[model samples]
Target: METQNYIEYELVDSVSDRNIMTDSREEAIHAFEKGWTVYEHHNTINQHSKFTQSNLTVTMMWNDNPEFQGS
Candidate 1:
C-alpha cells in the first residue's frame, strides 16, 4: 500500500458564504491577509488529522434610521 500526506487550505468568503479549496499555502496566506477567512486541513493516508481555522472576522451592522424596522 502506498501512503501520502498533504495539507489543504480552505478560503472562505463570509459575506457570500462561499468556499475555495487549494493545496498552495501561499495562496491561502494571501487570501487570509486580504480579509478572507482561512481554514487548514491535514490529510494522511489511513490516518485522522486535524482541521483548524486560521483566520476569522466578526461583522456588525447597525441601522440608525428610526423608520427602519428590520423587515
Candidate 2:
C-alpha cells in the first residue's frame, strides 16, 4: 500500500524566530508554555518505506512581546 506522511503541527518563536517539528501534542504545548506559538499542520502522510516507518511532524511558533522583554 502507498501512504503519505505530513507535518501535524508548526511551532515558531517570534522573539527568536526559532522553529521545531514534533510528533506529539504534549511537546507542542510545552513549547507554547515557554512563550512559543503552536500551529497545527494539516497535510497528507508520506508513504513509508519497507524498512523505514513514517513519523508525524508538529510545528510551534513563539514571539517575544515587547512589553515583556525586560521581565
Candidate 3:
C-alpha cells in the first residue's frame, strides 16, 4: 500500500472572470504575477491507513481597477 497526493492550481482573471486550472506551480505563479487570483487544491489519500483529506486555499492577487478610481 502506498500514499498518494495530488495538487492543482486555479487561476482566475478578475475583470473577465475567466479561469484556468493546471497542475504546474510555475504556471500558477506566472498567472498570479500577472494580477490573477490563485487558488490551490490539495488532495491526499492512503488506503492502507484509511486516511483521506482535501483542502483548498485562496491567494488573492488583484490590480487596481481604473473604473473604481475616485474622480
Candidate 1 structure lDDT: 0.57
Candidate 1 lDDT tens digits, 1-71: 86577867768777887789899988877888777766555555322222334433222222333221122
Taking the tens digit of each residue's C-alpha lDDT, what string does model 2 give over 24-68? 778876776676766555455331111111232222222323332
TM-score to native of every candidate shown: 0.58, 0.49, 0.57
**Best-matching candidate per lDDT:** 1
Residue runs of model 1 more than 4 Å from their true location after superposition: 45-71
Clashing pairs in 1: none
Q: Which of the two candidates, 1 or 2, achieves a greater TM-score against the reference?
A: 1
Weakest 10 consecutive residues, lDDT, candidate 1? 60-69
Candidate 1's error at 58, in angstroms? Answer: 18
Residue range 1-71, candidate 3, lDDT tens digits: 96568767667787998878788988877787787866565555211111112322322222223332212
State the displacement of the C-alpha of residue 39, model 3, in Å, after optimal TM-score superposition: 0.8
Q: Which stretches of candidate 3 lie above 4 Å from their native place?
A: 1-3, 45-71
Task: List clashing residue pairs in candidate 3.
Answer: none
1 or 3, greater by lDDT: 1
RMSD of each predicted structure? 12.8, 13.1, 13.3
